[model samples]
Target: MLEARNLYSYYGKSVVLQDLNFDLEPGSMLAVLGRNGVGKTTLLRTIMGLTDRTKGDLFFSGEPLGDRRTDERAMMGIGYVPQGREVVPRFTVAENLKMGTFARKDGKRAIPDKVFDLFPILKEFSERRGGDLSGGQQQQLAIGRALAMNPKMLLLDEPTEGIQPNIVQEIEEVIQTLNVEHGLTIVLVEQNIDFARRACDRFLVMDKGQVVVSGRGEDLNDEIANKHLTF
Candidate 1:
């Protein structure tokens, strides 16, 4: 559903990604793996047009995203959940999810029942302030906000990072359900190798801002992890 050809992304003058080429087919979940500062998050940012500049071409569903703004891209059906889970702190849970529906081209403001179904806690905490929630709850809110747009492709940066251990498993299951059951294409940047392999159909390993190793999920073995991913 998305293709990158010889992609290079920049933040101000520093070129963070170089000559990257990858394709994510429809309904497939692809994991982007790497150690810290290898441009994994930058890849997702570039896709969302959040980088300072990007060279080469990015095609979403056969259309080139040439100089498209971030909001425009969202309208074209790409949802982003950044590493920080930037939910509005002042907004109530219902208000935060409602903010997501503004991206809908149909002008519908109603939060989808699927979103509430996927995240029952969001419904329970509908009246609570976002800032009052725990870390894991905030992460779920972030994902819910993205889902409120009802995107065709979801870009998640480190979805399982920094949350409680008990809630991490629940988040993992949700990501999988979105891809496997709900048929949402996903590009996930994650540190957990075992979960990546189990949940994703394919994997790409990055080093120094470029893809160094890539294969089907079964191909991501111990040797590849030790060679490129060990910190």
Candidate 2:
């Protein structure tokens, strides 16, 4: 569903992603694993056109995404939940979710029922201010907000970061459901190796801004983790 070739990304004048390449098939999940500052987040930002400059080819569902604005890419069905779960702090839960629908090509604004099903807490806390929720609740709101756009591909950056263990499991199950049951293409930037192995169909290990090791999920064993991922 998505492809990149020799993808180089930059923030200002400094290049952050170096000659990366990968392909993701429809209904498949890809785990992007790396230590801090190895360009994992930049990969997702480049895909969303959030970076200042980029070189090389990016295609979504067969069409080249050349110089498309960030909003244009969103209209093309790419949902991004960046690190830190950047939900609108002052907005009510319902309002924050509604913001995601602004990118819908069909111009429909209603939040999808599937979003509520995936995160029932969002429905229960619909009237609460986003800033008032706990960390786990905010994380669910962030994912639900992304789902509101009805994206074909979802780019999640550390969706389980900074949450309690139980909520992390909840988020993991949601990610699995999104890929296995709902068939949403996902590129997950994750730190938890166990969850990555359990949820992803394929894996890519990034180092020094490049994809160094990539293979089927079962191939991401202890050796690869110790060599590329251990801190």
Candidate 3:
């Protein structure tokens, strides 16, 4: 289990997350929902230790991840796909996926064939420059790179943002397969309730740096989801 208790975060003294608490079970998906600028990304950053946690404790598999560096956390099975799909623009698709191998501790040098099975387009575009791919393809590459780590837990931010409908559906299916088929835990920060509704087994709704509502999957309060998440 991954637990965040009374968590808090800030950007140059402007508090972004406040006393946020949540838990994700193994092989399950938790969706973090809110409108833009509600500190959803900050929460993911804090979990990955990319942002400082001013208060509270982060426990992964019952071990506290206090003051751990970002790379250290990745080594400990925390994988992240930041909002911008930060693929190395100059690197080929294959090269970008290789970057995730560094997160593995067992000295496994080979990229698993399963990764290629998950995102077959990457194999086809193995030699293509990351920057040359369309936005949706780049997003697939980003997720594929994160998968290369073979992480037990995955964090994604706004993966469907600016993506085409078909690509969005593909991402959603990937999220489901990761949880059900592979037993991978996922914490997703998404703006589209439709996608979240289909992919996540539970959700946490944040506003003004606080989780104001949470519940089982699409079981979230529709009125609140509409009021806070919809523009």
Model 1 C-alpha lDDT per residue in residues 152-220, reported as the tens digit of each score: 999999988999999999999999999999999999999999999898999999999999999999889
- The weakest ten consecutive residues by lDDT in model 3 span 49-58
Q: Write the per-residue lDDT of candidate 2 for residues 1-231, one digit (tens) a residue.
A: 999999899998999999988999999999999999999998999999999999999999999886999999999999999999999999999999999999899999999999999999999999999999999999999999999999999999999999988998899999999999999999999999988988899999999899999999988899999999998
lDDT computed for candidate 2 = 0.94
lDDT of 1 at 139: 96
Number of colliding residue pairs in model 2 = 0
Candidate 2 segments exceeding 4 Å error: none
Q: List per-prediction Cα lDDT, in the order shown.
A: 0.94, 0.94, 0.88
Off by over 4 Å in 1: none
Higher-lDDT candidate of 1 and 3: 1
What's the TM-score of every candidate structure?
Answer: 0.98, 0.99, 0.96
Model 3: per-residue Cα lDDT over 111-138, one tens digit each: 8888889888999999999999999999
Clash pairs (backbone) in predicted model 2: none
RMSD (Cα, Å) of model 1: 0.7
State the TM-score for model 2: 0.99
